[model samples]
Target chain A: MLINVPETVVADALRGMAAAHPELTVDVENRVIIRRDAPVPGKVALVSGGGSGHEPLHGGFVGPGMLAAACPGEVFTSPVPDQMVRAAAAVDSGAGVLFVVKNYTGDVLNFDMAAELAEDEGIQVAKVLVEDDVAVTDSLYTAGRRGTGGTLFVEKIAGAAAEEGQPLERVEAIARQVAGASRSFGVALGACTTPAKGSPTFDLPAGELELGVGIHGEPGRERRPMMTSGEIAEAAVDAVLTDLEPRNPVLVLVNGMGATPLLELYGFNGEVQRVLAERGVAVARVLVGNYVTSLDMAGASVTLCQVDEELLRLWDAPVRTPALRWGM
Target chain B: MLINVPETVVADALRGMAAAHPELTVDVENRVIIRRDAPVPGKVALVSGGGSGHEPLHGGFVGPGMLAAACPGEVFTSPVPDQMVRAAAAVDSGAGVLFVVKNYTGDVLNFDMAAELAEDEGIQVAKVLVEDDVAVTDSLYTAGRRGTGGTLFVEKIAGAAAEEGQPLERVEAIARQVAGASRSFGVALGACTTPAKGSPTFDLPAGELELGVGIHGEPGRERRPMMTSGEIAEAAVDAVLTDLEPRNPVLVLVNGMGATPLLELYGFNGEVQRVLAERGVAVARVLVGNYVTSLDMAGASVTLCQVDEELLRLWDAPVRTPALRWGM
Candidate 1:
């Protein structure tokens, strides 16, 4: 097990992120990472959050032109409505706030409660649920598609639209558009060890694969024997393609599951590209790294988002968050 | 063992990086990642090389404000002079070129030979040897203080200066200055698996630690039982402080040795800052994460560079590379 965390794991780690990045304002009491200068006038503020183990996701993503604020839950646990209420209230401009909710039951419930909480206090709130994981139709903790890597696309594209001074409806529409257009599939070599559990969430015998695993270590469809990188890429890419066939000018992301080294991730990206090319899907823009991850789980996920000129422009817009930044 | 890389791992991964980042042009035969707009006329080009597994290091680091070209050797092996010579020739814009050679023996020797070869070919070359790891006066792989994370500082500060149109001599001098002023210390909780070996680099019994571990899995000073995060922070901080006491403002980097999740790193960063605050060393700036890493080794290193305003300015300068980017 590779968890070497301290007491108050989530609090301590959040504090560390605040210390490293002065641009992020940490509300220790509320447990949110806020943009130092929030409530950008007339801009639809974006707020996202989930379990904390996925570093740079909800928290590392809190910055200008991306998330106005991020509410982080404990490792692999859903954020409470209190955090969402406070984050939405704190970042809300005159324009309504938008919550980019991932499609997990707990997350959806909490975000829904928080949206109501904000509206009750005379604050307008909207949400665009991201449920892009095509791995399982339903999982242990999710009612439908489990939100995975495609959340990043929603966050980035919607964040850019909001930053461009779009109204609340326009930003929410962008989020919905991207959320519906993207699809992802993941394969895990092993399970992640949560701090609370002190052991792997599940066990996989040697040379066994946990195909289509969830970000929170939820069980996938099968326990197949180990497959070559080529086979794994083919399986994942085929799954994504079967769900939604992206034409030319696709954006591909081969993301690592924490413990996988960049070398392995890059190699996986090559295999992914090879499979996509063989399938006649052109990868116009590519991103390979650990954007979304299960803590210390050695595996990767492939995300393909069908993008036209507008989506590409929004995706390529300047993003200065801690995790994903470019074209600034 | 976390590694599941493709055949010819380094070559395949380098190709993946080339595909993802169009700004970078990879010379497959030479195994070098080159900046598309190399040899910025009248500016000193920077070249760095090392083993492949410490990725993004001499490779992910090649971009506009970083190395003009990076020569990657086989996993955990020093790059040969042939790769470095070709890189130097390709990136040299007639103002001349500088090499950021790590202190490892093979790396040093290869870079030295490349410098000579480049000079023979009517190209001027200068070198700044990074010897920042203070864990040992001599190591299994090096004759002197072995270079570690401080090489990144040299590369960035030097890269910014070069991009600002600094001449070869000035860029080389800045690199040398940064290299001299930085000190690093790393501890490993486990060993890495090389692709060629297909197993761990070494064995560390459960709960036993490898203090002052090298990036390439060399033995350290001791193999003691596991220590608390606080204690680990204390030992690493004390070692760096004893080596070079930062008077007021200092830059602290809590670098993770691959495999360690971002949560653990952030928690470690918190511990480090707590220790520093206790000792009253003002942290002017901080950077945490895996910049240089051993492939999937679960551990971290603390690097402290006593910085003045100039160094801080150089450090904060805009860098747009695959691995590190900000302030653009």
Candidate 2:
């Protein structure tokens, strides 16, 4: 079971986050984390949120040059509109606020309602829906692809563009472009047990694999007996490559599904890189770790984001976040 | 079961790390990773190593300021003296080299042998033996406390001191103080599967935990029924607090086992913060994530390092490494 009190997980986690990172402000009552330097005049504010189970995602992502504010809900649940509305209003400058919405129905509905409410209250709100998972056309959770690790690419690229003092429209375009060019595929070695339900989210027998699995333990393409890591990495890379079809260099993120070891992820990364190189794809940049994760799920997802010069420049730009930081 | 071929896991993982991070050099022939600019004259180079399964430890730590070189052995096995000898020689600027070693018998023995070999070759070598685990006075695999997450502290703090161009003796002294002042304790919810063994190193019942567990899955203080996250955090904090009679601010690291989720670790961190606050310990700096981990083990370790201005300054100094980087 996930190591937490089922009743007070989100609020408790937010407290520790505030203690560890003094650079951010945690409004525990409203359950929103905002960068201390938020609401910079004339600069577009980037906001992201979803379930709280995915740590270092929307909340840990809040800092200078990244997400201005993050609204965290309960585990694998969406934050309410009030939290989002407050975060947007607090971080919104004269320029505007961009909501980086992941493409889950709950998140979309809440964010949409919040955006409308914010605008009515005189806050300019724009939204970019992140739905870059190519693993399934439809899954157990939603009608289309469920948002996955590629949302990190959208956040980072969009955050960088905003850091450049770009207008809200320009940052939204960059975020949408990155999200559009990204594709992710994952494999689950085992199921993760949510704390509320102290059991595996799904059942997969020993030595079996769930190819193209969703982040929140949604069903995947098919179940097959476990294969060698080389074979598994090849499958994930092949799925992502088919969707990408990029002739240019790409940024590769080999994200762990919470429970997997860093070594295994890196081992998987070697095979993915080999396969990509053989397929004539140059991985100019790579991130190998858990950025987005399913809670304690044993598996990994590979996200390939096709990057042009501008996207690559933004990707390489300095960012200072609790989770992902570089060159700052 | 660990997602790779059992025979070539360490070497293959190293290949991926080298590719993902081009800032360091991989001496595949020697199974050692060295900084490209190693052997900088008059600089006190630092070296660290142990088993290979623990990623981002020795290898991921080898970069500009952290580790000058990291030798990798087979899974859960100590690196040979030859590997350590080569690493120390390679990174020994005229100022000499310091090896940050865990307190494991194998690691201590190998590093000791390597120090002799390096000294025989006219390259002075010093070492800091980390024995910071405060869970027990003795453990299954060790005569005294077993070095765990505190090794990362010794490495980081010493690396920073070395980066300041301190003499070898000064750097070693700094490492020793950090190591001696640190205390760690871990609890394992499940066992980890070693690649070569292809099975769990130990067994835990459905709702039991191995408290005060070692990173290698060695037997701990005792087995007990699984408790709530708040209970677990409290137990761990109490253990560490008894070991560290802190009268000043501290550096805290709530490290995750390989398979634990970042969210749960942060959840645990919250309880830890509450416990620490109740105890009146001021946490000056904090880090929460998977730094030192057992391969695929579902657990977490809490390390508390009593720090003064000097140690805090060294920790805050610019460090450029694959595993840990901030303000660089």
Stretches of model 2 off by over 4 angstroms after superposition: A2-4
**lDDT accuracy of residue B181 in candidate 1:** 77
Error of 1 at B211 (Å): 1.3
Each candidate's lDDT (Cα)? 0.85, 0.87
Q: Write the per-residue lDDT of candidate 2 for residues A22-69, one digit (tens) a residue.
A: 999899889999999888888999988998777779887887768999
- The per-model DockQ list reads 0.56, 0.67
Q: Tens-digit lDDT track for model 2 on B1-328?
A: 5466788787778877777888889877689999999887778999999987777787888877789999988888899999999998888877999998888888899999999999999998999899998877666667788888888889999998898899989999999999988999999998998877777878888899988998889887889998878888888989988878998899999998888777777778888888888889998988988898898888898999998899999999888888888868
Local error of candidate 1 at B115, Å? 1.1
In CAPRI terms, model 2 is classed as medium
Tell me, per candidate, how large a share of the native contacts it keeps.
Answer: 0.48, 0.59
**DockQ of predicted model 1:** 0.56
Q: State candidate 1's TM-score.
A: 0.98
Give the per-residue Cα lDDT of candidate 2 at A262.
80
What are the per-residue Cα lDDT tens digits for candidate 1 across A1-328? 3234534888878778878888778987679889988988889999999988888687877777789999989888899999999998889987989999998899999999999999999888999999999988788889999999998888888999999999998999889989988999888887787878776788977578888888887888788988877788988999999999776478888988888889878877878888888999877799998889888888899999988888899888998878888766
Clashing residue pairs, backbone N/CA/C < 3 A, model 1: none
